[model samples]
Target: MPIELKMPALSPTMEEGTLAKWLVKEGDSVSSGDLLAEIETDKATMEFEAVDEGVITKLLVAEGTDGVKVGTVIAVIAGEDDDSASAPKTAPAAPKAEVAAPPPPAAAPVASTPAPAPATASGDERIKASPLARRIAAERAVDLSQISGSGPNGRIVKQDVEAAIGGASAAPAAPPAASAPQAAPAPKPAPVAAIETDIPHEVVKLSNMRKTIARRLTESKQQVPHIYLTVDVRLDALLKLRSELNASLESRGVKLSVNDMLVKALALSLIQVPKCNVSFAGDTMLQYSRADISVAVSVPTGLITPIVKGADSKTLSVISTEISELAGRAKEGKLQPHEYQGGTASISNMGMMGIKQFEAVINPPQGMILAIGAGEKRPYIVDDALAIATVMSATGSFDHRAIDGADGAELMKVFKELVEKPLGLVA
Candidate 1:
């Protein structure tokens, strides 16, 4: 029997994805850990791997194919002794651990030839490990047998493997490097009564990311009731601290950015005012214990938010390093799903772009998103007298359903104090 290759759910919310490109073709011999294809989802382009070894008998979907539903058969593989020509044509039962909608019949559990163990240190005994974990463990010369796994059924995942090595180097998952999200572009209109333009314009097709962004933002505005709170923040103390810290840390190759400090501040503020760090689930509200700040990084395809998990707990240098790494990977479309999936709140900084102020749309399910504006010299009262201070506008857009206006204001107040006092950030 030909082994069916169904699209695996790469993400919790991913229902379908674009078959961006195939890494293997018909008659190609594959191993359990080999990369088979690069699947492009709304979030990122992730490489798919084969779990079972075989000769690729057929490719059912073409490269660049879009809307391939999860659990849909995209290819076929024949085992070493199977007759490919006589393989029965049938609907594929989902693979092991596959989460299929209207799941396969319980009585007829899909039987399969066991895949060769992927663990690099396997002998008579085999350790179950993901291809990524196996690869990482091999590179690091770490023994999989010594480390227990945290993944499903004691299967080792990346995080588990990394923990076995020097754990501090492993960055915690935060929300993506995003705070202020660029408003999702307006949706494409219906075909009827379409306007024809004489002015020259190219019809740029929207990628999965753009389409998802549009649909999601449209839904956020229409569904989530948002309350906006803006606060003008003094930057002199924070700027002074940043410069001193950067100079002292120069020998260690560590530098902190204003945005990095702000990420920390926002996270600390969320911890202080837990009332604002909540998501509205129908009939229930989820209040996060720690803040996972998503900072937006712009990529060629679109924007992606690679999280820095516990921003408040991490040092400014650590936060800066993680953001740099996450943002770089995000641009390259190399981030794993876990890096950007969930967050307690978000922060989008437009300060570098010189934008004075703007309200950022809430990334749904996350209660609030903080929009940061450029800091500039502004007239203000200092020491009970007229003075000029470098100030930036920080706006918190809260989901009204989950958080009250007063709670949102308190969060904003705390965020401002952290920035102005500045020492609190390092402490």
Candidate 2:
């Protein structure tokens, strides 16, 4: 029997992905765990491995095809004993099994075109519109029958519905029935209409990573009630300790960074102030036993947070090594889902970019994110006398729903104390 290779869900939230490239072509013999295709998910471009050993019979989804839905059969594999020549040759030709949904067309640049005539018997005839357009039409009370579609096969997309709402006379929709089994979901913001301009510019489609980042950050700002607390921490002691530790470990090639120590400090502080290390699960809060810190690493596609599991319990050298490796892989778009997914808290250090201070948007579910700024020599009180000390401004953005203002402040205070004392990080 021929084996069907369907699109695997790369991430928990992934419903679809781009078939970036095929590592194996049709007619290639594959074994279990062999590389199949590189799928570009919302977070990263990860390689999919073959689970069943067989000969590649047909590649249903071509390379560069975007929006391939999960569970959609992307390929057909023949058993080792079966003849490869007996399998289907062309993609359009159906295999032995039935395929419900075909793969989407290869990615292409989007261009707006004037739609055809509007105002037809939408009641009798079936309406051809995208799901997003239908949703927007329902919310804005825009009659689809009065609007012309501009998408493939004259299908109405979000832009079409938005245009109708803007120019077409739309009557107000009646309120949803209260006796309905479930309430209507919150209306998502409509796509922004393109503006006419004379400025020379090129339109680039947003990558999955960029799109996800935009959507998530917007949701965070809109939904999460944030409480920000800032504190200046002296880094002189921590820097001194880092230097001494690096000198002793020079032969082993394990050098410590200020950010590495700070990672440790933040994890330790989370352990001490357990209230801040929590996730907001509506109507309840989840407090973590150990701190898993998500360190923000900027990749070419977008920003990703690779976690250091149990940073509070790991040694500074171990944390430094692990961070370096994780960051390298993150930039290469090779990080697995688990490596970048969940964390008790997050830390974003823009110190290398010379950013003085900036409030980071809290990643959803997690209670808070610590923003680290550049450390510079500044005047500070030393033994009741003013003296120059290396100091940095750290800000904590807490989800007011899960973590109280006092808890966030205490986390910051403890973080500051750990950094100033320096030895507590190792202890």
Candidate 3:
């Protein structure tokens, strides 16, 4: 008997993926734990491993095929005792899976009369249209029954509804009667001509990672109620402390970055003001026990947050080294799901980019994100006297549903104190 190899979900949130490449061809011998194929999910490209030893019998899905649904059979394998020669060499018949499909012909039955009425099938029977197509039809005032379906089993789809609307708009209108006093027909507006220029441009298709980023960010803004709080903190002490510590640790190959110190300070503050370290669970609030910090790293694909687990417990050198390695792997798209998935809080430092200050969107399941800005010399009041000092602005974006404004302010207060004092971070 031939064993079917289905497309595996590379991540928990992965519903579909591209069958980027196949490692083995038909009749190739494979063993358990063998590399089977490269599956490209929305987040990363992961290798698929074989669990059972077998010979390649058939490739059900081809390489470069995108939007292959999870659980869809991608290949077939013959057991060691089974004869590979007897198994099928070609791919089995399957539905075409594409990231974007062309609009099919209208499937709804077309009514001869042009009156605005709901489209229906013959003898007032209901039309067979997809839910999306039905919604589009309602929006466009299209009659689904009059349009022909181009989908499977004569089902109406989005394209079919759109095509029907286009056809209706393009149809010739009836002429006015000669006996009636006719008003002058309004002049048709001229179509705008395309702007001609020598500027070179190219259309690049959106990658899965880019698509996921857009979707998740959109959801974050729309679903989460964000409250932003900004505070300016003097960073001279923290910078001086970092410089002195780096000098002492240079022999041990440990150099601490200001961002690393900030991560520790944030973790400690979250522990001090535990209310800020919570996730909004709709009917409940989930207060986290440990401060796992998700550090946002901008990769070529998009923004990814690789977490530094238990930041409060880890030493400054350890946090710095871990972040360096995690960031490098994240940029290369080599991070595992667990390495980037969950965290109690997040830190997005744009200070390196010279950004002064900006509000950040809350990554869901996490209550707040600390946005760090550039440290620059600015006028400040110290001991009732104004003086120039090195200062940085930190903004905390909190989920108002889970964390109170007072608690968020307290967290910011503690974070500022830790950075300004400098010793609390090391102690």
Clashes of each: 18, 0, 12
Best by lDDT: 1
The CA lDDT of each predicted structure is 0.77, 0.77, 0.76
Q: In terms of TM-score, which candidate is strongest?
A: 1
Give one digit per residue, the lDDT tens place, for model 1 in 272-336: 99998777765666667778888988899877777788887999999999999999889989887
> In candidate 3, residue 19 scores what lDDT?
90
The all-Cα superposition gives candidate 3 an RMSD in Å to the true structure of 18.6
Give RMSD to native, each candidate: 7.0, 16.5, 18.6
What is the per-residue lDDT of model 3 for residues 261-373, given as tens digits with 9 covering 90 to 100?
Answer: 99999999999999998877656566777888999999887889988888988899999999999999888877766566667899999999999999999887688999999
Residue-level lDDT for 360 in candidate 2: 98
- TM-scores, all models, native as reference: 0.81, 0.77, 0.74
> Which sections of candidate 2 miss by over 4 Å?
81-86, 89-187
Angstrom error at residue 309, model 2: 0.7
Model 2, span 289-402: residue lDDT tens: 778889999999889998888898999999999999999999999877667766778999998888889999998767789999999989999999999999899999999987
Task: Supply candidate 2's per-residue lDDT for 373.
Answer: 97
| Alpha-carbon deviation at 423 in model 2, angstroms | 0.5
